[model samples]
Target: MEAFAVPGLPEFETGDDIATAIEAACDLRGDDVLCVASTIVSKVEGRTATLADYPAGPRAREIAARFEEQTGEERDPRFAQAVLEESTDLVMDEPFLLTETRFGHVGVNAGIDRSNTGGAELLLLPKRPSESARRIRERLSVDASVVVTDTSGRPFRHGQTGVAIGWAGMPASRDWRGETDRDGHELEVTVESVVDELAATANLVSGEGDDGTPAVVVRDWTFGDHEGSENLYRSVEGDFVRQALREWHYEQ
Candidate 1:
């Protein structure tokens, strides 16, 4: 499969037609998978905000003070408040704020991005990324799949890679369980995230800085004959790492 960014896109703004802008920039085929950076998605969805919007309360001030005490770098209490407002649970409160967004995605600062924020002080993630993808998919003229992507630092990795936060018109994973390998060993638990793969491919061309290409079209990739699953995020009850983090947080 080949992926290329849609060129000549203007800096998007609130209420900009993402489907129209993409269709104007490139001719997408029905079989293609369209990957969109969450930046542009947040832009069109009007998720911009400023530090003034979130007044720092006692909890936010405490969190910021603790972070400052540990890192020796002062953090804005308003920023902490913004993170808290966007999150349903705070996974970590020291050194950095690791929190779970209301929509179930977990990330630092509840995914309230400051870089490339379309000139806003903060660019919040889409309220519901999956629904955002679905809306974009429905507006498209072709029968293409859509994946909303974000740059995410992996647990044990040094740098960040693209991860799918929202997807439409396709299952999240290609289930490989019970399938036979070359040596005839049945696959017990192998699920491939096609959306994340596509997102990474798109990011390869999308670039991190000033490329201005936030949307990419991936062509000629097929899921093949395989079972699909939509289970991606894990609940707190079953997520050992999250539980461990919580335990550590309380222990501190």
Candidate 2:
């Protein structure tokens, strides 16, 4: 697979479409997956809030509230967004994982950032990345996949790596249960996330380092038709309220 880093992208603004940039970077006939960082999408959508404009505490509170409203669940009331990268369980100076947001998006800074942006403009995750990807695919009129990526922290890791929080035109999870390997050994339940792998590969070129690039197109790969991230969410029956009760009762 070949990855090409797209350079010379300007500070994106609200309503600034990426159709042209994406088209120029793509090889519509060849097999390729366009991996875009959430930060650039956020910039294009103008998803920033000025910390200087509003008082820090108030701004943070408002952001937290908005996150809760968007995610339909309670989050850390004091959580603040920033720009930072993470390493992995065995490697230092490696950007292999992404952080998870309260909304279950795993990417860098929980898909938030402040660096390389306009004054006081903090970047956020795309409002609807899967939808965005679908739209881009339609615009290009090609047989390519799109992935919106972010950084995430692992279970036993001290740092973070990249992951696909949103994907279109690709299967984030491939179920290999009951299937056979080369030796006809029944694959005892192995689910692979191709989207995350694509994102990590793209990140190799579009690093947080001084590459000055935020997007990449990965060529030569076979992927499934586009689904979405909506179904990926785990169903929350009634656990949240119970957890709240546990905390409240303990306090009492």
- After superposition, the stretches of candidate 2 with alpha carbons farther than 4 Å from their true spots are 52-103, 106-110, 224-252
The models' CA-based lDDT, in order, is: 0.91, 0.60
Per-residue lDDT over 160-226 for candidate 2, one digit per residue giving the tens place of the 0 to 100 score = 6767777777667776666688888887756667788788888778877656677788876775443
Candidate 1, residues 1-252, lDDT tens digits: the string is 888889899999999989988998899889999999999999999999999999999999998898877778889999999999999999988778889988788898888899898899999999999999999999999999999999887677799888899999999999998899888999876999888888889889898898898999999999889999998788999999999988785333
Model 1: residue 54 alpha-carbon error in angstroms: 0.3
Report the poorest 10 consecutive residues by lDDT, candidate 1.
243-252
Q: Which stretches of candidate 1 lie over 4 Å from their true place?
A: 249-252
